[model samples]
Target: MIHVVFNEPDVTVINQAIELDENLKGDVVLIRDDYAVGPIQNLYLGEGREARKQWWSAVLAGGDYDGKADSGEVDDYKTVAELVGTMRRNPDEIIWIWAAQNKHDVSGYYWLLHFMKEFQGRVFILYLNNLPFINEKGQLFYPTWLSTIPPKEFLKAKKLARPITLSEFEVDPDEWIRLANEGKQVRILEGGKKLSQYGEEYYDEELKKFITGDWQKASKVINQFLSKARQTTGDAYLLWRLKKIVSGEGYDVQGEMKAMKDFEVKQKVGQPA
Candidate 1:
């Protein structure tokens, strides 16, 4: 058995749970990229390699957007392709997918389905986004990340995992293709339904207040804006938005807005307050 999960944190939590549960047996694989915010056209098609290359080129040009790579040499396309290779090698292994309802996890799930078409093994899913679980306080809550659930709760979820039916496989992949081509920031909810044009709800009105004066530091502006954010948005996404603002004359901030780890928004920034 093999368990496929999104992100490093999920891999850690699932591995820990599996170790404690003597009934569960499998190796864990992590899909380290966030598919929600990047280009997806032709990602599953024959031209996917070139398409991905172009997307990476743009991302690198837009300022440093290093994903959750252990080193500076991580290749998203190769990583996914390797997973496909693994499936081809062990066609009979039972593969379990643990995914949340967010675009990131849902998008990755669809990509996995696309790759698993040639696999001869059984596939099961533990979609936790909508599933309610009893927390430490004994209160039921819907968790957005697998890391949020305790090991005992995760074991329970594993027990309830079901095989992906043929009907689901047929319908869900088509929906995923449709959503992938739409090229919008969207959320994949229950039943493989897509809610398009998301993120507007999280737009902070206070962002405009930072545009005052001839120039302000982009780092300071981002800090100010995020301080009032209604939701927890990734620092990478916020920094990308700031770069777009600079490019569009929406604002001006100095210094090199590098990757998330080394990013620093310097002085002399201008934009609409």
Candidate 2:
């Protein structure tokens, strides 16, 4: 069996869990691209490689708010395609996808479904959208990602994996088409329904106000907000909002880079004080 997930952090957690529980020692493939936020035109069409290259070109051209392009982004997706090709060759191996409810995971799941149509292998998904989870404190919450669940809790969730029926894939292609065309930052739910789109206001309003009060670097502002706020928004989502604010408000791009560097340095040494 092959287990597939969206990001490196997820890969890390799953690997750790696999070490703890022998049942999860199957081949794990990490899809490193983020389909949630950029130009995804023709992403689900044609051969996955060429289409992915085109998409990467579009993303690179857009230039992230920090005015930098991740040169290795295209190579990362190529690696994912190679892994998927391996799955395609092993027609009898069951493929399990660990997907969350958010735009990142759901969007990636759609692309994965589109790519795996030719595989003769059975596909199963541990979809975590509406599923309720109990934290260590015994509080119930709908987790947006597998990273949010403790390793012990994840073992419990693994039992919920269900096989994907042909009908589900049949219904998703057109929905993927519609989603690729929409060009919005949002998630597609079950049965082709769109999730509520999050806007600038969706961010912590107090954080935005705090940042506007002083000319701080984007990364610094984000770090400070995450430390002070009780919300659970992911760093990627916060960084995206920070870029939007920088571009919209004409903040310095160099400062954003410095802030990011400082944050990284702090992380390497110890948590920032």
Candidate 3:
């Protein structure tokens, strides 16, 4: 069996869980792209994928992860293609896709399942949506990220795995295709397999709330927004948006724009500190 996950931290926790339960042992595949925050139009095609890569280049330019967008490190298309090849070569093999209740994971699920129809029965999903689990403190709570759940609790999560249904295999891919054609840059989970699309600037207004007339380190503003906002994105993405905010009216900027720490930003002089 192959265990597939979306994020890096999840790989660590899943590995720990495997150590505790030999039955859960499998090669773990981490899909490195965050499908929730980039262009999806014709994503399966070479030209469309290149367009999204170029867009990422712009979003990541001058940030700490500069050039990462073009790097082979973030290639999900290649990962999925290899997974498909593996499944084709060994018909007896099975795949388990693990996802938590968050835009990042669910978006990945949508993108992944679209290509998994031929292996319907062989593909299983363990979606932790609205499911409660015991944390390290022994307190029960719903987790938005898989990495937040105690490694021992993964044994319990294992029971939730079920083969991807015929209905889902039919309906879900259509939904993903629709989302791709819509050509939006951001996706938000509405609930259970449902996603709503939004412009790339969806978080800009909320991000600006942290900026005031007093200039603050760009890193500080991004860190605070990630901590305080109900909805948040990666620091790199936020820093990109903050730079856009600085370039437009209503924000004052100083210092180099090479990276988050290299810059400072604030509300324009008369905007109130």
Candidate 4:
């Protein structure tokens, strides 16, 4: 079974594919993030306006089982786990849906990145560009003074790498900041702290102190950023360094664990949560 994400711009295409395919195997877990503004915004704002209030659900609100949410407000569906339970009871195929126009969808992706750890199927992304090509009326353009051309600074933007397990890289945060500043990459393998060369057991213990222990979400965001970085730099080393930083934070060193862990500690940095 395949898990497809029909993120916005390409929703119509995804729906069309579903209609054309008489009998496609696997289930579809449709995830409509709060960022999915309806027809009005689509007609007016191409990429100018942020998704409406509903868009915050992935980052703030909870998930909703009913597609027909009568409450008028969105349930912040922050993690795939929230949706996974709903799909568990359904026999139909599952596919996670989000919209590209809404940056909030990235938050959903962050959630899905960690979901891979607990989820049993393969995950994939599809670029749906149904809207116009260029944004003519943006508030600001790319800062040419600091412009980093893609092909030279890195490679292409669209390349898929197999999800790397979080257990590979082993190092301290002090070391991690050092590596990140140096432009190196790390890709850690999957394993527990006891197996790690770095002594990170204390870090894990500290992580448990939070009310919402979301290390998985944290790792997912870092990986998402690193994966994109690796694609840009075309540097295997950069990816390798990321592995170290992610693995060292130390918890469940598996898929999605990085993201969840990162989520917990991010807010608490420099202050008590």
lDDT of each: 0.65, 0.63, 0.90, 0.32
Per-residue lDDT tens digits of candidate 3, residues 82-139? 9999999999999999999999999899889877889989999999999999988889
Model 2 error, position 178 (Å): 0.5
What's the CA RMSD for each of the models? Answer: 4.4, 7.0, 1.1, 19.2
Alpha carbon RMSD to native, model 1: 4.4
lDDT by residue for model 2 (179-254), tens:
6666554343432235434333366454565454334555667778878874435555566555555554323344
What are the per-residue Cα lDDT tens digits for candidate 4 across 138-211? 33223111111121111111232233334312232223234223331111212221111122121232333332
Candidate 1 pairs with clashing backbones: 208-273, 215-269, 216-269, 251-270, 251-271, 252-269, 252-270
Q: Count of backbone clashes for each model?
A: 7, 0, 1, 57
**Which lDDT tens digits does candidate 1 get at residues 174-257?**
876777667655343444446444542233334545545655555566777767754334555556666655555444445566
Residue 148 of candidate 2: its Cα lDDT?
81
Name the top TM-score candidate: 3
How far residue 104's Cα lies from its native spot in candidate 1, in Å, is 0.9
**Which candidate model has the greater TM-score, 3 or 4?**
3
State every prediction's TM-score relative to the real structure.
0.76, 0.71, 0.97, 0.28
